[model samples]
Target: MASRLFKRPWTRSNDGSEATTASRPETPDDDDFHDAEEAVLHPDAHEEGGLAFNNRELLESQRSAIYELIRDMGMKFLTGHINLINMSLPVKMFEPRSYLEKLTDVWVYPALLTKAASCTDPVERMRWTVTWFVAGLQHVFQSWRKPFNPLLGETYQASQPDGSTVQMEQISHHPPISAFQITGPGYLFVGHSQPEVTFRANAIKTTAKGMRMLHFADGTSIDIVYPAYYMRGILSGTPRGEMVGTARFTDATHGLVCDVTFGKADGAAPSDRLLNRSDTCTATLCQLDRTNLASAQANSSASADASQERGWSKRLGGLTGRLTSLSLINRADNGLPEGSQVIGRGLGNWLSYFEWDHHRYWSIGESHATLWQPDPAALPSDCRFREDLVALRAGDVKQSQVLKEQLEVRQRQDAKLRKP
Candidate 1:
């Protein structure tokens, strides 16, 4: 027999008394959860992406045991012999939310988009957008625990009171891919992401490759590519996460490009080693000559001669910032002429208030605006109502484990049936 997906007990009291609608705790309305005044931020953002973890000490012990097992199977874990993706850890190691829901962490500070859209200056607008891009990565630095994998076709949709809505759907199952779209006042963000995970002896690396595009009402758009991440010290030492490599942001409309280089906070001796102490980045913005680009493209298509190529771009000011503290300063080449470009500087943290060019951009505590909240009236197909995830959220580890296995089995059976 098929099992019921959503089994929340909001309709009845524990004593079997019928609960009044007003007395009953809010079930999923599929909209914003609380008023700005009543909104509460989770203590550990990773552990409680939406729902709190059941037991802290027990989970930590479980994690230590798992780590020891992985350490013992050093070669097996390091090599492709052990596929971590297919390996299921205890439900205690997973956050209740699905990967689709976890993606919403980026929108915790959605006001950044509004600032970018409203800005008149093209350079300043890109800066705001870049700030938002960096802000969105905050969650990745918090934790590396596993999240529930959404079933194919499962969806999650929510809208803020301001009419800004975000929707995510699990589009693929084999190599799980999530498709997302965010529509707000003056901008539309759409992307399809597929996470690539690999485990090494020393670290576990994760990279999500996707086509992320942010479009504004003014016909300007930005193309984004994220950096690679690594969770180091898996076998021994204290485990920590680091964002490595260069993340690219190209504003093709304005002929502007920003390449952010992430490094360790300790500015230690520069080595080819991937391990970094903390999350720090330097973003260099450059302006491409549109006329030169057009000419170069035309020439390239007309003839394959390299001698006919032209200079394509010139360096603009850049932002040297720390992701943890949310402080960035204008960094320009010493050789560049002064007063040639309007360089801006920003300092302070994003948690309280982030001041850019002496103006506050984000003040989470003081601001009355509520962060993104899931709606109770979401579609029946939403992942929020998924049996396994719901059980996990309620701290029913055994039930969740069974449900998760059942769901996986059903998915496998469906795939087999579909195959000719």
Candidate 2:
């Protein structure tokens, strides 16, 4: 069977931005508003000393007026077809359980809602849906940026059983500034702090023309460029752990490259220790571009929403689908090497709202560490052998004639023999 749902064609604006505003024209004047108010407040509006009838009458009047306005715009009634007015009315009447939940269910989650109702073309609908979802989410959540304290009442200075406090900041030239408590999946830390210091320096700014190198602050120097958003994720405790962050550095020509690396940070070492010493396990270098970042963020939001609604079966099927396509293309192009392992990491946890359940949290040791990799070679020779051994270790059986016979057979078997 074909898919039942579809996405609405997005209405694109002149400037290429997604257009989310309703197409319905506003009410002609204050006449409708005044009429509705009068209908509610009139003496006949009340019945049995209550204004229940009047309220209903007023609501009906308002609804009629809105419908009429929608009709005048050459569009169907506000409730006609799949317009914004129709989509929003149910949410207004019912009062969504949660704002985020409503957005997901009514707008973000339902791709078909837009596709089925949209007047625009499919390409436009896809583009507009993505833009609309991104803009709408940002508008709703960005304003609620109160400092989130995931670890309520958690102390920053945690004492281990040994009694030594985790040294958050070793000796640094920069004076310690503010500290905030943050908690992630596996680990919790009390006082996370960052210090900033400013030094006066001369710098040559980069332009489209060519490179201009400059220096200031005595020995301190930097090649000037547009500021970029920087992000870092760090894991640190008494025994060294992983830290990942974007770093800015220049080559011999003073061209800057932003390097993002994931690895362990040596707590014993100084703050300025070279990243290479800390086992630069994974690194990706992307040129600084705000537009690209914004686009990626938008796409990420859209994909995240879709991932949440997909069923387990569909998700698994999608994995096979992608693998088949890749295998075919790779074979034709001779792109991939022989015996290349397709290490597929499904976005299984993306369907969950809780960050702790996600792979990102698992990597950072936020919650319980989960086994991410399994070795097929580690399987026991016999399917029941591992379980039987475990059961024996758990005192399931003290002694058995069958177990003795199996051991004897194993000792004599050349295939099962191992060098001491």
Candidate 3:
């Protein structure tokens, strides 16, 4: 039996509120709640590349805001490393034994900073960014007590004196300038350690102390010094330790404007053992700017042709040539010998000896042991030949005959004047 039952419809209040608002179970899927959370977490949720897409005006404003954020962040990250190294305690240690350990943790900052610059992952970037600044001061104590080997190659060996052999294995190709990045603004700290020595029979065995120069991103540089003396210790051990140098900032744009002097503690004292004290007066300017790579490439291509033309001009200008017979009769002062075989042996020697490219040396003997190194400074300055001098020195028969005829005219004038 079906029964008809009246059901009440949902009612709304007259206070202009949401009608029939469901008192649904509090679920996490509410649209208004989700939207509010998204707004709080990512305010630019609708933007692409951090720029608003709804309107041109909004996009312009977003772009400017984003750029400023990036610029401020980059500057802070870059300069933060410099400040951290400036205020470190291990850096203050003067003892040679503990120097290396003190600077061990210092490399973290630069390593992290370099990684941050290269990193693309946001998580890794954040980690490195934080690590870059927190890493404390770094002091690199270079031992002067250790023997330094100057590596030389075969080419260099052939040029140097006998018994002045260099240890080719020890030569390092790394430039000190690269370590500091002097091309940009930064600070550099250089440290010097005292010489350590050992007593050998009749000879004082000594190793020079080590010196290290630290370059910071900021312009400040610091230097530290350590004391080391070589004496027979209770045990036999090689004295190997580190030293520190001054700390100061240098402007990358202006470079070092003062003379930074470094010398041994004993003034002009010749000791194989390294000295302890040193001083610096900074004056030289170092600057780093963009190199014109394109212009340099262009110049390299035309350099060969330009060099050839210059060589031809120098050789031809030295040649002594005879004047045509027709001109000899017409012109009184032709400034040329009648007929002269240009003696260009000296010019040929000059050309043969001259090196267009000064980079390489010319082998002289068969074994090539003796090399004729070109000296551009030694080249003759008076390359142009005088016609009168050429006429007097002519050796060839045809050249002498032409010169005699020209000289006969001059002799006749002298004889006429003498007859009076």
Candidate 4:
């Protein structure tokens, strides 16, 4: 159905030759400047991507510093067995968020997909819906900090810009499960996810199992599932990760399904697998970087085939799938740059559409900083009420660690009381 529906429709002349179209350069209207103002320039253009000779050296040194961290990590992996929680890990590796906040990182982007959730056309909605899920692959190599596990019965809630709100609760401590539901005027989303944690010699693999069921105002429902994720270079090198599974979204009423493939198939040699080459982040970083760039192309036409794009729109076809292989969208099809024809029908700029930006590198930081209230609004039992969270966010690693262990101990005690 998608193959037939998403075929590029090209115009032809009387002679039957192919016709082409060009998008006018964006002309900003007064409302557009007032309206189109998305990112405020740092007041310096050259400072954006340009670099002086000395600055170039400094930047290279910075990357080299990060490169060294990878090498040192590899050396450490050569030592002893690292547990799933990495008890022996240097304190520097932990990013202070509770396990609950880390999972929220997974939910943030989906909330931005209200357009897809609210779409009336089932097919287009599925396309938008699944494409957005695949777009989550962008977070594959983000940061290496593993969040602390959430306590049983602990919960978190976030309201969306679309006037909708979603809540997640830690329903179990034994298997560590989180059940989330998004409710509002036009759509409803409910899902449960739990991870089976495993340790590879040089990496950590998380097999995430769950499905998010999206229901629309017209009774349309779509099931979205996320792919498995692995943290690479953890044991003996610079840590990174990538999305390595095939995710599917199936629409019940329409009998439609969209499958999105992310990351590369494992191609390590038998020896490479046994003796993890964690020293080099080269291969994984290369793949993740390319994936990231392609996703970035969706944000700016200048990064893509500019002649056809007129910026992302508010409609279904605006953000046409280009990066992650949209069985529903294409970039260069059959050796022909399907530029012009994909204009309005292409996948939208997911970043702008979902209002995601540089801060994604911070993951759940924005949610903790601005979205949730710490005092009166946050219950005494809320995670925001934890002093450890405050110390961690403030970069006080030692105090945060002390608080982390105390909280873990308390959780264990509470769990015992709940058992029959």
lDDT of 1 by residue, 1-420 (tens): 121121111233445565543575554653322111121222322221211223456447645856766677765766653435556666766778888877777676567778899988777888788777666665564445678888988889987766788888776777777777788889888766778777766667887865567778998877777778776655554455556776666665565666565654234335412112234445556665656445434543343222124211010001111011101111111221222232444332222223344343443344443367787789999988999888988989899999999988999999899889
Model 1 alpha-carbon drift over 4 Å, by segment: 1-59, 68-74, 79-83, 142-144, 264-277, 295-370
Model 4 stretches astray by more than 4 angstroms: 1-92, 106-112, 235-239, 263-376
Question: lDDT of candidate 1?
Answer: 0.58
**What digit string (tens of lDDT, one per residue) describes model 4 on residues 1-420?**
010111112222335354431222334553322112132211111111110122344335444543465476674543444344424233344556666556655444544356676677675566556544534443433345556666677666666554566566666676666666667556777666677766545556787654456778887866565656665544332344455545555553454544444422144344322112221111100011333334333543443343235222111121122211122212111121222121111211111111111111111212221132223354455655567777878889788878778877887798788789
lDDT, candidate 3, at 309:
63
Count clashing pairs, candidate 2: 14
lDDT (C-alpha, whole model) for all candidates: 0.58, 0.23, 0.24, 0.44
lDDT of 3 at 168: 11
Using TM-score, give the best candidate's number: 1
Candidate no. 4 TM-score:
0.55
TM-scores, all candidates, are 0.67, 0.16, 0.16, 0.55
Reference-based TM-score, model 1: 0.67
Q: Candidate 2, which ten residues in sequence have the lowest lDDT sum?
A: 348-357
Give the 10-residue window scoring lowest on summed lDDT in candidate 3. 346-355
